[model samples]
Target: MLDNNLDTIINKTYIIDKTPLNEEKIKKVIISLKDSIISSKEEITAANAIDIKNHNGNIIDFSIIERIFKNINNEKIYYGNVTTLKKDNNKYYGKQYFDKGNVLIFNTGNPYIILEIFLKNFLAGNTSIIVTTNYAYGLNKLLETIIKTVLETNNLSPDFINLLTTDAPEELLKNNYANIDLVIALGNKSFQNKITNYSKVPVLLSGYETFDLYIDEMLDKTFLTKIINLHLPMHVYINKNLKIDLRGSMLVDGVEEAIMQINYNGNGYSSAIFTSNDDNAANFISKVKSKIVTVNTSPTIERLMDIQVKDLVLEKTVIYPNKKKN
Candidate 1:
């Protein structure tokens, strides 16, 4: 149960310094977590296998294991050193600060995605309270145990990470908790609506929305088929032969149409365009309304990590006498 002591632990995060020493320490924790999971792969799989059997819903497969390591590798590269004072303008100086209170995260997906969110929040110097509303008995607990060990090993408080296995986390949300500065919910539309309806705290919704890929006829047909195959796992392909429909994604006549369709129907999360035409790529990237836009490649986890920091942090500007005497 999250208690007053957890609030104290969350309060302590405000004092975390943005020094190189601190940065290295956080990085070490991530690296150690990766190593620990790798060493215990067999045991971890066995534990989750029982969880799958008990769940009797969806089978927990090896893909989860791969995602665990993949998320670790993706996030370990972000050292979270964005806290520096800079000139906002000639008369003002600005600096970024992590949230002074705890971040309450409710997610139902590959359990390891919590690890990614935890690392992002932890590096930004905000404590996380993870409430897994799905099958929390297996991988969630295992991940929490390993993370607590890593935290203690690195001389950080184990309370830095809290994983609540309770199914009804909305109960916790109903309280007027002063320490909860942010709430991030990752799941389907129904799940997101549940969180939004209950959470008085601000909510950032992620996951569950289908990512659309707009193929322009300017590209060669063979390359389009290859790209579709490469992205098969992420997108819903109506045809195995690569005849992608609007359900998965529709072929557009030009970049303008692609931009229009995506802007009108996209989830405003992340969007990408695979085009060799520099003008087309530039036009699509500039016109698309999604938060993260990329050219010739998909947005990476590193990009998400960068944006996560922005989401969890606030910018402070201190106006002063003009240094240039303007």
Candidate 2:
């Protein structure tokens, strides 16, 4: 009776741990994610070798590590500091953390063993989507829209989007490439240099570059508060030389708050947008005004707006709004 009970418990644990993800469903997600990553110019690399040093202070050959590296090249090893560790009776059991190229390292007893199991399970169940862009602004809007669509369609958790962004090295790409079903490329000649030649997944060039928003105004507390409430995702690029006194959370939170405040103040709704270039900035602002909301025009805003509308409108024309009787 005792033996039977133990076996049952062991079987139950195995069943719980071994439950797989839906590969077909995950494949769609992975394709979308991969396209976004590629279009964004995010770097993707592969793992090369596994360094094994046993507790006896001797270099040991781990078959699992050998097998893992055998499929990948040596140039793609991710080197990073271990961020977390498991403790067995107060002693170190395993360690995990990000490496130099943002590669995650799990250097416990057998890192490859854990990694293999993880990859196997991840591939077996969930589909991974990779989006590569040159920068955050590259496919920011499109990717954001796609993410929202995915969330609404599948009822997936928003936290899954966080995995789409990482500073990890290319080594991890090898494990990923093995299970990926689709790859989407963005940009024309510029993106050609960004992708690898030997990807096993089916690659599709989606489209040309999309414009991103840019803000050049000095954002004050009041304005920041208004911007925050708008509920728009914007990438803030402060000048490297200009010292802006604001906490990271404050900046992120303030934009949402500011949008709300603007709506309440009856000064029209404001949505914060960001881009790396002036033209893209103008295009984004135009799109927002036409499709999103009536944007407040400042000197900086006026300049960008004018640049965008210059060819469409006659030059040196002044128009004024009619004052209404209260």
Candidate 3:
């Protein structure tokens, strides 16, 4: 079944590459998708409920649903800010950004994060083939419907997003016939490693095996617990029990030690430090090696878009010498 769809999906992306989506149309599609999701909340929840039950009462499924609704509005903010290069000196130099074609997003059991990654690709005008496992069939089906309607209503290609629910995602990953330009895999180290090995194309990874939060000194145990609880559910770094069981939850000697631990052991996706001292926060934020460094605040759902931005598009630098015709 996937083999049959691969050609059509690749062809659709070729059409998009030739005739790119304008900013207005992109905005319209995003708006429609957000509205559709809001209107379909109850149905979405119901669909996710089945996934949860199938996964043996995985409460994380519900959390994914809620996060989607909570963060849907934030998608609008990403529009109108597509960066471009400015002409410099006598050289007509600038950069051009283009959408990657046919991104295969592998769902590692959480529909919400996959959906978030898909929208980032959508915003950048990339066509996506979202491969979901059987556990998330119901939720993904509903999302596929909602997104397709939005795209068609905006007079865009419905093939811009494709959802394939298979028990074995590796089959799709290993398929050489598909014109897959990139693969976005959201999972732990083992899952990411498998996808990386299976994919013929380059793989962009989100989520993490271990994420760290470093503290200079021990605070109230209650306060530390609150910090962990706030960031735990939103991230894959924590386990199902909601305990900060791994490397991220640790006490350090000082800001310097905290910075070193995070830089060495962290996944470079995100890291946070909670401190009232401006000097410590500044030092930590500046020195941390993660893509996102925050002080006195945990990473929020809004930052998810920021972290995944680089993986969504392709960039090229253009340079031309400006010479007067004589």
Identify the candidate with maximal TM-score: 3
As for TM-score, the candidate ahead, 1 or 2, is 1
lDDT of 3 by residue, 197-280 (tens): 888888887654234566543444576666566534322222122333444345445777667766665566677666667898
Candidate 1 C-alpha error for residue 226, in Å: 15
TM-score of each: 0.62, 0.22, 0.67
Lowest summed lDDT across 10 adjacent residues in model 1 is found at 231-240
The reply for model 3, stretches above 4 Å from the true place, is 1-20, 56-90, 208-307, 320-326
lDDT of 2 by residue, 1-326 (tens): 01122223223323332122243444455455434434533221111111112111112224433443333221221112132334443344433222111111111112222223222223333222333222222222333454545544654443222113333223333444332433333322233223444344444331121111223345454765455443222223233223453333223233333333323321112234432445545544554432233223221121111111111111222233444556
Task: State the lDDT at 10 in candidate 2.
Answer: 27
Cα error, candidate 1, residue 176 (Å): 1.6
Give lDDT per model, in order: 0.61, 0.30, 0.64
For residue 312, model 2's alpha carbon misses the true position, in angstroms, by: 38
lDDT of 1: 0.61
Report the error of model 3 at residue 254, Å: 15
Clashes of each: 0, 58, 1
Deviation in Å, model 1, residue 253 alpha carbon: 20
